[model samples]
Target: MSTSTIFHRVAFIIGGGSNVGMHVAQKLKTEGYRVAFGSRNPDIATLEQKELFPVSVDASNPESIKSAFDLVRTNLGEPSIVVHNVGIHFQPPVRNDPFSVSSDTFAKSCNIQLALFVAVQETLASFRSDKSTTPKVFIGTGNGLPFLKNMPPFFLALASQKATMYTMMDYASRAYAPEGFRFHYATLVGPDGGLPNLDPSAEVGFYNSGPAHAKAFWNLISADVAKSWDYRFTYAGEPLMT
Candidate 1:
């Protein structure tokens, strides 16, 4: 260990302008981690940090992600954590036409929600390079609509992509855990089954407060050992997976 080396734990939050993303960033800062969040839109990405960094990154584009990580490495050192919070949605059709998957919807979901290929490539490059410490990676997600029964057609298209994402995340967590990396896929269930199969009447759910979700996520990231918190769903700080 050279005294010249500076170790500042950094966490980058993608889509960090969202309600959930903002809270997550705030929480990470409180936990003493340098944070950066990327947004596609400049308007919402306006949030700046005196000590932290923010950049423009299109989740779909590997070049954009690579560029952002490059800057992070230069400015903040290799990121010890990466949280993918980007999301995409399509409005449900009116009470008439059946739900149809549009090419636009499919592509946008791949770009935003799944964040396709670039996301994983950059994560391994940045986090896996330094094996002396454990690197944490978490993807914020919602309950898979496709796997659930009795869902409305309005969600058909979105469900297809999200379900695929869930499965892929599962595989990633399993494959990477064998190494010294911590990979997590936390699916949130909000009020009124907001994202998936949830009872509208259930109180004390994940939506109880935005900070609660952030706290739970932080707990997973800061855990002493990587538990099965990855590949799990949580509601109000409770892990749904045993």
Candidate 2:
């Protein structure tokens, strides 16, 4: 399916309250997509937007995710593009001690991984039902943790979850490629392959901003079919075929 034909199609974004999610949603809206923002507490401004639909969703709950997709389908038709931008990141109380992290916190990370699995299943079902020739794209956001060999001890849980997510996306991309479904896992990192810097004063070259992420996502979605099968890539759309 060509980008021109899918301009007016529907796009559903999970975790749309995040900075990167909001930028991607705006990009899709500007490109003529009927955008649906799924978050636990959507911003009032987003809910008021004309072509943007804000649906409440809990990223850790499978039922909540399904319900949110249902609402999107009811209001904006089936989503041809689905983005799983939900993630959990926090430091252990003892900073460098991975064992200091509570079991509940680790469980929360597991729940998020399960949620992504559910979201991917929901997207696949939606695409199978829709008869339109529009692109069936699913983008999963990640960081450098999954690919790192010496990850920080305090980020153990997050690293584990990200590794699982990367594996899942890899499988999905290969399994669904023949069906015309594109599954991409985008790693948002610096040009030198460093993690994102949240500090506003950080050097521009060392940080990957929300707008950069948005642009990378758009590039993935608009990529030609021959290039679409490349699942893992950097925030700048550079392929990491490994």
Best by TM-score: 2
Candidate 2 residues lying further than 4 Å off, grouped into runs, are 1-8, 203-208, 226-242
Over the stretch 1-242, how does candidate 2's per-residue lDDT look in tens digits?
23334334899999975567888898988887889888898875846655577789999888899898888777777899999887777689999999788998888888888888899999998899788887889988777787766877988888877787788888999999889998877876654566655576865522436777788788888877535432444545456434
At residue 26, what lDDT does model 2 achieve? 89
Model 2 residue pairs with clashes: none
CA displacement after TM-score superposition, residue 68 of candidate 2 (Å): 0.8
lDDT of each: 0.64, 0.78
Tell me how many residue pairs clash in candidate 2.
0
- Best-matching candidate per lDDT: 2
TM-score of each: 0.79, 0.88
Candidate 1 stretches greater than 4 Å from native: 1-7, 42-46, 49-51, 92-101, 190-209, 229-235
Tens-digit per-residue lDDT, 12-130, candidate 1: 87766655777887888888877777777644324653444676788766678788888677766677788776545565445323355566655666655445456766777887665
